[model samples]
Target chain A: MVDMISMPDDSTTAVDRALDAVLTRLAERAIPRGAAALALIRAASDATTGGKRFRPALVVAAFDAFDGDRGATPGLWDVAAAFELLHTAFVIHDDLIDRDIERRGVPNVGGTFRSRARSLGVADDGADRIGDAAAVLAGDILLYEAARLVAVADIAADQRVPLFGLLDDAVLVSAIGELADVEQAVVPGEPETTQLLSTAHDKTAVYSFCAPLAAGAVLAGADAGDRAVLMTVGADLGLAFQLVDDLIGTFGSEAQAGRDAGADLREAKRTPLISLARETSAWPQVSSALALAPTGPIAVRAAQRELHESGARDRLVALIGQTLASVRRRATELPTEPRALIERLATGIEGRIP
Target chain B: MVDMISMPDDSTTAVDRALDAVLTRLAERAIPRGAAALALIRAASDATTGGKRFRPALVVAAFDAFDGDRGATPGLWDVAAAFELLHTAFVIHDDLIDRDIERRGVPNVGGTFRSRARSLGVADDGADRIGDAAAVLAGDILLYEAARLVAVADIAADQRVPLFGLLDDAVLVSAIGELADVEQAVVPGEPETTQLLSTAHDKTAVYSFCAPLAAGAVLAGADAGDRAVLMTVGADLGLAFQLVDDLIGTFGSEAQAGRDAGADLREAKRTPLISLARETSAWPQVSSALALAPTGPIAVRAAQRELHESGARDRLVALIGQTLASVRRRATELPTEPRALIERLATGIEGRIP
Candidate 1:
C-alpha cells in the first residue's frame, strides 16, 4: 500500500505551512468575488491539499543539497509551494481529461464541482458542463497563481530569468507530452517505443524530478554543468518512477495505489508494457481482452496473464532497474546533501519498480 | 462585424515577425519529436494569425502615448507580441469550452485536430477527445510562451514585477469570468445584472483593455497616476466594446458577424439583453421561445424578435452609448496618441452599438 504515515519533520511542516499561506492569501482575495467565486476558490484550495507532496519535497531537498545558507533566502518556501501548486493544477486538468471522478480517495475537483452543480438543481448535462468548466478554470487559476508566486519571488535578479525558463519549459513540455499521449492512444495503431519514452520523460520525469531539482540548484547558484547533471538525474528518476506507477496501476490492488485497478486496461492505454506485449505470441488474446476490458473482467484477467507470461513485466523491471542505477550514479557526482536525498528517493522508487 | 481588412501597419508587422521568430525557433527544436508534435505547433501558429490584432495595437498605442523615445527600447515588440500570444491562447481555450467548431471562418484548433484524427480512421468519440486534448495543450503552450516572452523581456527590473502582476491577475480573473459565464448559462434563474457586468469587465475589459493599456504605460516608464488612468480608460472602452459585441451577436446578420446568428439565444446565453428581456412584457414569449430553441429555427427567431420588440435592444444601445462616452471622457485625460486610438476604437464600436 502507498505510505501515508511519515513522521512529521520540520521540512514537511514548512511545506504545509507554505501551502496554507498561499490558500489564505487567495481566499482573502476571493472574498470580494462573492459566494460563487468564493466557492470556486475553495474547491481549488481543497484540491491543493492532501497530495503526496513528493514534488515539494524534491524541491526542498534539491535546494538543501546545495548547502546554500538557507537563512539568507526568503523565497525557498514560495518556490517549493509553487511546485506543489503546479502539480495541483496538472492533476486537476489530468483528471478532467481522463474523465476521472475520484482522486486521492475523494471526489476530485471536477467531481466536487459536479456535485455542487447538481445540488443547485442543475440538469445532468448542465451539471456536467458546470463541473468540467469549474475544474478547467480552477486549474487555470492555479497555474496563474503558481507562475505569479515564482515571478514575484524574492530571488536574485540574475536568477529569475533562468528559473522562470525552467518552470515554463517544464509546463510546456509536459503539455506536449500529454498531446503525444492522446495521439498514441487514439491513432489506431501500436505506439512506437520512442514516442512512449518521450511522453514519459516530458509528462512525468521533467516536472516531477528535473525541474524542481534544477530549480533548487539554480537558486543555490549552481553552475551550468551542475544544473545539467541535476536535470539528467531527475529525468532518469522520473521515468523510472512513472514505470513503477504504471506497474502498480496494472498489477497492484486499488488499496495499494489509491485508485481503481484495471483503469489502464479499461482505457486501452498504450503503455510500454502493452506495446511490448503486442510483440509476443499472446498478442491476439491480449488485444482481444483489451477490447472487452470493462464489460469482461475475465477477458481483462486473460490479458493480464498474457502480459505476465509474455515477459513484458520482466522487461519493464529490467528497464526500471537500469534507470534507477543511472539516477544513483548521477547523484553520487553531486554534493553530499543532494546525493543522500536523491539516493533515498531512488531507493523508494526501486521498491515499487516491479 | 469585425473589420478583418485592416492594413498591415508597422506595429502589426512587428508583432507578426516576433511570432514568426518564436515559431521558427520552436520548429527547429520540434524536429526530434516527429510529425505529430510539429503539426500541433503549426496549428497553434495558424491560430495566432489573422486576428484584428486589436490588443497588440492597444499595447503599442498606449506605449506610444507615453512618448518614450521609441528608438531606445527593444522590448516593446516582445511585450506586444506577448499580448497577441495571450489572446491566441485565450481564444483556443474559449473555443474548446464553448465546443465551437469554427473560428475565423474555418475549423478551429480543436476542429482541425479532430478532423486529422477522423481522417486517420479513429472513432468519432476518440477523434473528439483528440481534438479537445490537442486544443487544451496548444492553449497551454501558448500561455507558457507568452509568459516566457515577458519574463525574458528587456524591461527594467523594477517594472517586471508589476507587469507580471498585471498579466497574472488578468489571466486569473478571466478564468473566473469564464466560470461565471458557464454558471449563468446553466443555472435556471435569470442572472443578476451585477453578475453580467462583472463578467464583462473580468473577461473582456481587464484583459482586452485595462491590462494592455497599463502594460504599455508601464513599459514606457509612466508614473503610477498615468498608468492608473490608462487602466480606467481601458476598462471603460473594453466594457463598451463587449456591449457592442453582444449587440452584434444578437442583431447582426450571419454574414456580417461571421457565425450563426441567434447563437446566444439558441444556447440560452445570459447576456444583458437576455436579462433585460426577462424583465419586459415579452417575457413569456421570449422564455418559451428560448426553451424551444434547439428543436426549431422558428422558435429561435421568435425569441430574437421578442428580444428586439421588448425594448431590450434599445436599452442595450443606450448602455453602450453611456459606456462609450465614459471611455472617451477617460481618454481625454491621457496623452494624445492613446486618446486618438481610443476615440477611433470607440467610434468603430459605436457603429455596431445598436
Candidate 2:
C-alpha cells in the first residue's frame, strides 16, 4: 500500500515545506471543532513545535532509509502527528502534575489556563481547580485526536489496524508509568534507581521512542525483523536521551535547560544522575552545596566537581560510551542505519553534561 | 456502503435482536492494545448497560422508525455503541464534577477508582487526586472511542463525512456546559427559570438526548427536515425526562429512588422545580421542608401542591404535554412505527413522575 515511488526524492525540496502547509491546514480544520479544542491545540502546538524536531525527522529518515517513498502516503504525516499528540499530552499533564510554570519559554497549559481563568475574574482556588480540570481534558482530547487521526488515515485498512493497537499500548504503559511517578512523588523517598529507571523505560523509552520509531518502520514496510531491531535501538537510545535530558535540567543553564535549574533537584525526581550521585556519596555534599549556592557560575562549578568526584559524571560518560558501542553493534542487524542516526541524536543531546 | 436491499427488514424481530447482540459485542471489545482501553471499555459497558437503556433505545428506535435496517451493514452496531459510549463518558465526568457517589446503584467511575486506589494503600488525598486524574482520562477515552467507532461504521462515506465532526461538536458543548455549570454552582441566589432552563437545556437536554438522537438519525439516512424534528422532540423530551428524574430523586423512597433523596438539594443543582420554587418566593418554606423531610410520598405530595399553587407544575406539565405531542407528530414522518414506540416510551417515562 505504501508505494516507495510515491515519496519525494532528495532532489525535491518541497516535501518538508509541504509538510508545514499541510500541518497549518490541519490546524485550521481542527480549530472550528470548538473553542476549547482550538485553545488546546494552540497551546499544545506551541510546546510541540518549540522542541527539537527529532521525532518528525525520524519519520522522514526511516521512510528514506527503507527506500520508502516520502510522498507515498499522507498516512506518514498522520503517524508523525500521532506521535506529537501523544507526546504533547504527556508534556501537558506532566507539567500540571509537576506544577511547572514555563516550558520552552511558554507557560505550561495548566498555568495558562489558570491565568486565563483569573483574568476572567475567577477566584484563585476555583481557577486552580478549573485549570487542573481543563488541562486534564485537553490532554485527553489531544491524545484522542491523535488516535482518531490515525484511525481516519486513508491508508490500507490492514496497515491502520495495528497503529491504534500500538498507540493504545503506548498510552497504557505511559499511564502506568505516570502512576508510578505520582506515587514516587508522594512517598518519603530514597527509592532505588532501578525502580526509577524502569519507570523511565516504560514512560519515556517505550512510548517516546520505541513506538514512534517502530511505527515509522512499519509504515515503510519494514519486515518483522527490521521492526524488532528498530525497537531495541529505539528503547536504548530513548533511555539515554532521557538521562541526558535529566542531566541538562540540573546542570545546564536555564536557557539551555528549557527548565528551571536543578528542576529534578527541586522535585526530587529520581533521575539516574541523582541516583548515581547518591550511590557514590556525592549527593550528601552536592545536596548541601545546592542549598548553599552563592548565586553564580562558581556555585554551579563547585556542584559539578562534587558530582564528578562522586563518580556520577564518570558513570554517565561510561554508560553513554557503552550505549554507543551497543548501538554500533546492533546496527549490523538492520538496514537504513537508523541505529546510527539515533546515536547521533543521542550524542548531540547528551553533550550538555560538560 | 450501507446497502439497503441487503438489509433485513426492521419488522423481522430476530433481525432487530441480532443488531442488539452486535452492538453489545462491539462494546465488549475494549482493546487488545492494553489495560487502559480495556479498563475504560469495561467501565463504559458496566455503567452504560446498568442504566435504563434509554439512550440506546432512542438510537435504535430512530433508526427503525425510518425502516432503517439494523442488519443493513451490521455497522449500525457502531452507531449504537457510539451513543452509549458518549453517554457513558458524560455520566462519568459529570459525576466526578458533581461529586455524586452513586450512578445506577453502584459507585461511579471516580468512586470506583478511588476505592480501588485506597484498597491498594494509596493515601486518601493521593487516591482522590489519582482517581480524579484516572477518571478524567477514562472518560475522555470513552468519548473519543465513541467517535472512533462511528467512523468505523460502513456508512456511505459521503453521508458520514460529518458524523465525527457532529460528535466532536457535541463533546465540546457538553464540556463547556460542564464548565458553565461548575462556574454557576456558587452563585448563591437563584437564577431565573428561563436562565436555569437554558443552562439545563444545553447541558443535559442536548447532551443526554438531542445529540445522541440526532446522531442516530444521521446514521439512519434521515433528511435535514427529519433531523430537525428529531432534535426538537428529543430536546423537549430530554428536559421533561430530567424534570421527572429530578422529582423522583427529590421524593422517591430508597428503593424507588435508588439514589439520594435530596441529592439535587444537597448539590444545589438548578432543576426547574427548584428554580420555580425560588422564583415564586415559596422556596424558603419548601426548601426547609425539602431539607427536613425530603423523603416518602408525603414529600412528593407536598412538593406537588407547592408546584401547583405556584403555577410551576401546570406550566411544566403543559410544556411536557406539548413536547410529547410533537414527538407524536414527528412519528408520522418515520418510515416505520418505532417512532411510535419511542413516543410511548417517552410518555411512560414522563408519566412516572408521581
Candidate 3:
C-alpha cells in the first residue's frame, strides 16, 4: 500500500495553504454581501475540508517531476487547489443527485442546511426543499470559484488559454458522465460493460486525474508529447482507483469506506461488480439475495457473500491488477520522479482493502 | 414602451450569430462523446433559445456606446452571447429550484428529460429524479460554457482579466441572492423590506444587468468611471425589470407572463409586494384568502384582489417608476447610445401588461 500519509509534506502544505488563501479571499468578498452570503461561503469551506487531497497531490507531483520551482511558481498551487475545489463542487452536486445528506460521516452542505431549516421549525418536506436549493447554490459558487482560480492563476500569459480549456473540457466531460450514470440507474436494464466503463471514465477520471496531471504539465511548459503521456497514465490510474472504490463500497467496512457498505446494493446502482457477477455460477443466489429487499443487512450480506464466492470478485481484482500494470508500463515514458509517483498512486489504489 | 421587435437589427443579428457559433462549437465538441452528450448539448441549445435576449442586448448596447466597431471587434458579440448563456443557466437552475417543468410555456430541460423517462416506462418518482439530475447537469454545463466563452473571447489580453473578474463577481452575488430568496420563502416570518430588496438586487440585477454592462465596458476599454456609471444604471434597470416581472407574475394574464400567473401566490413567495401588503388593512382578508388553500383559483383571486385594493400593487408600480427614473438619471452620465438603450430597456420592462 502506498501510504497516503507518506505524500511529501511540502506539497501537502502548499496545497493546504493555497486552499486557505482561496477560502479567505472568498470570505473577504462575501463580507459585504451580508450574513446569508457568508453562511453559504462557510458551507462551501466545510465541504472542501477532509478530502485526502489526492488530486492536488497529482498536480504537485507532476509539477515537481518537471522541476517546476514551487516558490517561484506559486500559481501551480492555485491550479492544484482549483482541482480540489472542482472536486468539492462535484461532490456537493453528486450528493444532491443521490439524495445523500451525509458525506464522510458528517452532514454535507445539503444536510447542514436541512438541519438548520428543521431547527427553525420547518417541516420535513420544506426543509428538504431548502436543503436542496442550498446545495445547488453552494455547488454553483464553488464551481465558479474553481474556474475563477484557473482564470486568475498568475501563470505565463500564453499558458492561460490551455489551462482554461482543460478545465472547461473536464467540467463538460464530467457532467456528461454524471448524466450517463443517472440515466443508467433510471432506465431499467443491464448497462453494457463498455458503457459502464465509459461512464466511469467520463464521470471520474477526466476531472480527478487527467486534468490535474495535464494541468501541471501545462504549467510546467511541458511539450505536448509528455502531457499526452501523463494524461494516459492518469486515465489508467483513475480507472484503477474507481474500481477499487467500487470494491470497497460494496464489501468493505463502513470505517474503511467512510460510508455505508451496503449503499450501492440498496440503491441498485449498476456497478461493474454487479454486472460481472451476473455471468458467474452464483448468479442465481446473488440475484435472489439482491431481490429480497437489498436494503436489509441480511440481504446485503448474502449478496456480498455470493458475489465473493462467485469468482466475480477475483475477476475484478485481476482486472484492476491488469490496469495497474498498464499504468506502470505507460509511466515508463515519463521521467523517474513522475513515473515513480504514478506507480505509487496506482499501488495505493490497488492496496485499498474491502 | 421600448418595443422588443425594434431592437437594432445589426446588433441582434450579431448576437444571434455569436450564439449560433457557440452552440455549433459545443455540438462539434460533443460529436465524439456519443448520443448522451449530444442530447445534453441539444437540451442546452433549446434552453438558450426564445428568450428576449435582453441581457445580450445590454452587452451590445454598452459596447456600441463606446463606438466599439462590430466588424473589427467581433468578440464583443461573444461577450454578449456569454450573458445570454449565463441567463439560460440561471433559468434552468431556477426552474429546478421552483420545481417547474415548463419554462416560457414549453417543457424545460427537466421536463423534457422527465417526459423521456416516462415514455420509457419509468415510474413518476423515478422519472422526476432523473429529470432533476438532468436539469442539474444541464445547468452546470451551460454555466461553464458561459465562463468558457468569456475566457476564450478574442479581446485584448489586458481586458480579459477584468471581464473574468466581472463574470465571477456576478456569479457569486447572484448565488448569494438566490440563497437569500430561497431562505425568505422557507423561513416562517415576513421578510424585511430591505432584505427582500437586497435579494432582488443580488439575485436578478447583478448578472442580468450589471455584469453584462460592465463586461461590455471592459471589452470597449472604457474608463472605470464610465463602467461604474453603467453598472449603477444597469442595477436600477434590473430592479425595475424584476419589480415589473413580479407584478406581471401576480396580476397579468398567463399569456402575457408566459407562465402561470398564480405561481407566486401558490408558492407563497415573499416578494416586496407581499411584504408591503402585510402592513396594510387588507392583510386580514389577504391572509384568510391565502389560508384557504392558496393553490386554488378562488383563493388566488381573492388574495390578488386584496393586494390590488390595498394599494400595494400601485406601490410596487410606483417603485418601478422610481427605479426607472433613477436608471434614466444615471444613464445621463453615459454616452448617448448606451443611455438610450438603457432607458429603452427600462421603459420596455415598465410597459409589460398586467
Candidate 4:
C-alpha cells in the first residue's frame, strides 16, 4: 500500500486541486470598490493559471518521502499550491522587468494589460505606464496571496514560522539574483562561470529548489541533518535545472519552448552557457549575436552555430551531468524514499538539456 | 511604570534601535556576487532612512496603549521596524511608478540610481531603465526583509501566524489601492470622493493604520474583539491622515512637507480636496492649473488660490473634523490608555490642515 518508489505520482493532481481551491476562495471574495481593483485581481488569477508545477512537485515529493502516511497529510497540498503561486508572482515581475510581451506562447500579464490600455485609447507611453503599473500591482498581490495561503495552511503552529521564513528568504535571495542579472547585462564583458552560477543559485536554486525541499522536510518534523542534506541536493538540482533552461532559451525551438527562443540573446543575458562560450575563440560572434537588439532567427542560428562550434553546448551538457552526479552522490546519504525520489528528479533534469 | 496616557513615548528610540540592527545585519551579510547586487542593497538601506517612521509609531502606540509593561515587550520594536521597512518598500516602488526625481527633498532610490547610471556614461533611456530595475529589485528585497523580521519576531508560535497574515493582507490590499490610484490617474475626469476614500482605505488604511494597530494587539495576545476595534479605529484614522496629507501636498510649502508642494497637482493626482474643488465653479481654472506641464510656481499658486476661493480648503478642514470626530467616538469605547492616545492622535491629524 505504501508505494514510496514513485515519489510524486499523485502530487500533481493533489496540488492542482489545492490550487483550484485557492482560486475559488479568491473568486468568492469580491475585490472592494470597483473594476480597476477587480482587473488587477483578474490579472493575478490569470498569472496563476498555467505552469509546469515543477517546484511544487519537489515540495510534495520531499514531504511524502520523509513523513508517514503522506496521503493523510492534507497540509502538503496548500504548501505545494503556495509554491506555485509564488513562482507565478516572480515570473510576472520578471517579464515586466525584461519588457517581454509574451510568456507560454500567449500574452503575459503585462502584455494583456497593455492591450487593455490601448483599447482604452491611452497613448503609447501612457499605455505602457498603465500596463507596467497594473502588472506590478498584480505581482505584489499574488506574492501576498501566496504567503497568506501558506500561513493559513493546516500545518502545525510551530511549523508555520520556518515555512514562511523559507518562502521569505527565497524572495530575498532571488531579488539579489535578479539585481546581479541586471548588473551583468549593463557591464561590458561576460560574467565568469562561477559568478553566473552563484547568481543562478541565488535567483532560482534556493527558492525554486532548496526552499521547497527544506520546507517540506521541516513540515514533517524532520531532523536538522536530514533537512540540510535535502537542501544541498536541491541546490545542485536547481543549478542543473537553470543550466538546462539556459540551453533551451538559447538553442531550443520556439515551438517547443512556447516563448521567444532568442530572448536571452536579445537581452544579453549572461548565462553560464554564454559565459563558457565566451572563453573560446568564438567570443566575438557570440558577443555580436547577444548585442543584437531585436534578435532575428538568422542571428539566433548564427549564435547557436558559434556556441556549438566552440564546444560550449558540450561543456554545458557536461556541467549539467556533473551537477546531477553530485545530486546523486548526495542522495545516497538520504533515507530510502527520498533517495529514490531525488535520483529520479536528477534524471528528469538531466533529460531536459538536449 | 505603565504610563498609559503617554502611549508610545519611548517607542521611537526602540524602533530606531531595531531598524539600525536590521540594517547592520544586512550590511554584514555580503551578497555573494558583484558591485551591482551590493549597490542595490545599499540603495535599499538608503530608502529605509529619513522617513518619519509614522507607521511604526502607530504600532508601538497601539501596543503600549493596551498591554501592561509597555516597554517590556521588546518584540514590539521588531514589529515596528518591519512596518517601517514595508513602508519604505512601497515608497520606493511608488516613486518609481510616478517617475518622481525627488523625495523628502533629496534624490530617491530611483533618482539616485539614475544618477549613478548617468555617471557611468549610460544614455538617458538606458539610465532610466537601470534606475527602474534597481528600484524594483530594491523594493522586492525590502518587502521580503520586512516579512522576515516579523516571522522571526519574539512572539509565541501561535501568535506568529496571525501576525504574518496581517502583514500579508496589508500588502495585498495596498496593491489593490495602488492599482485604483493608477486607473484614476489615467481616466479623464476627477475621481469621485467615495472612490478616492476607498482607495485610501486600501492603500494607507490597511498597511499604515490597521496593520500596525492589529499587529501590536496580536503581539500582546489581545482578543478578537479588541483587535477588531483597533482595526476599525485605524481605518478611520488612516482616511483622516490621507486627507491631511493631500492638504499638505497641495497647499503647504516644500520646506514644511520636505517634498514638492504641488507634486499632487503636477501628477494630476485626484485627491479628495481636488475632487471637492472640481465641484465648485472654479473647474476651468483648477483644471488648467493641474494640466500645467511643469506646473511652475505661477500655476501652482493659481491652483492654490482657486481652491481656497472655492471654499475647498474649508470643506476639507470640515471633512477632517468629521473624520476625527468619528475616531473620537470610537476611541471612547476603548480602554483608558488607548482612548487617550486615540483622541490625541485625532487632535494631531486635525491640526495638520489649514
Best by DockQ: 3
For model 2 the local lDDT of residue A171 reads 65
Measured by lDDT, the strongest candidate is 3
lDDT of 3 by residue, B146-235 (tens): 877777777777887788878877888888888788778878877898789888888888898889888877777789998898789878
lDDT by residue (A190-249, candidate 1, tens digit) is: 777766877877788888789988888888887788889888998898888888888877
lDDT of 4 at A299: 78
TM-score, per-candidate, Cα-based? 0.92, 0.78, 0.94, 0.91
Q: Give chain B TM-scores in order.
A: 0.92, 0.78, 0.92, 0.90
In terms of docking quality, model 4 is: acceptable
Residue pairs with backbone atoms closer than 3 Å in model 3 (clashes):
none
DockQ of each: 0.57, 0.22, 0.65, 0.48
lDDT of 4 by residue, A206-246 (tens): 88889988888887678889888988998898888888888
Docking class of 3: medium
Candidates sorted by lDDT, descending order?
3, 1, 4, 2
State the lDDT of candidate 4 residue by residue for B215-235, as single tens digits: 888877678888888788888
Better of 2 and 4 by TM-score: 4
Ranking by DockQ: 3, 1, 4, 2
C-alpha RMSD of each candidate structure in angstroms: 3.1, 6.6, 2.6, 3.7
Candidate 4 docks with a DockQ of: 0.48
Candidate 1, lDDT over the whole model: 0.78
Which digits, one per residue and each the tens of the lDDT, describe model 3 over residues A1-354? 236424488788888998998888888999998877887789989999878787788777777778777666768888899998999999999999988999877999899989888887888888888889889988987887788777777777787788877787788889888888888887876888778778878888889888888888888778888888888887887788788888887888887866677677776778888888887888888888778636588888888888889988898899889988999888899888777777778867877847
Candidate 3: list runs displaced more than 4 Å: A1-7, A260-268, A291-302, B1-7, B260-268, B286-305
| Per-residue lDDT of candidate 1, residues B1-354 (tens digit) | 245113248777887887787777676666676776787888898898777777777778777778765577678888888888888888888887777868966988898998999988899988888888888778877776777778777777787888887797678777778878888888887788778977877787878888987888888888888788777877877788777778767777776566777666666668888887777888887777778876656777777787778888888888888888888887787777767767877887787654
User: What TM-score does structure 4 among the candidates reach?
Assistant: 0.91
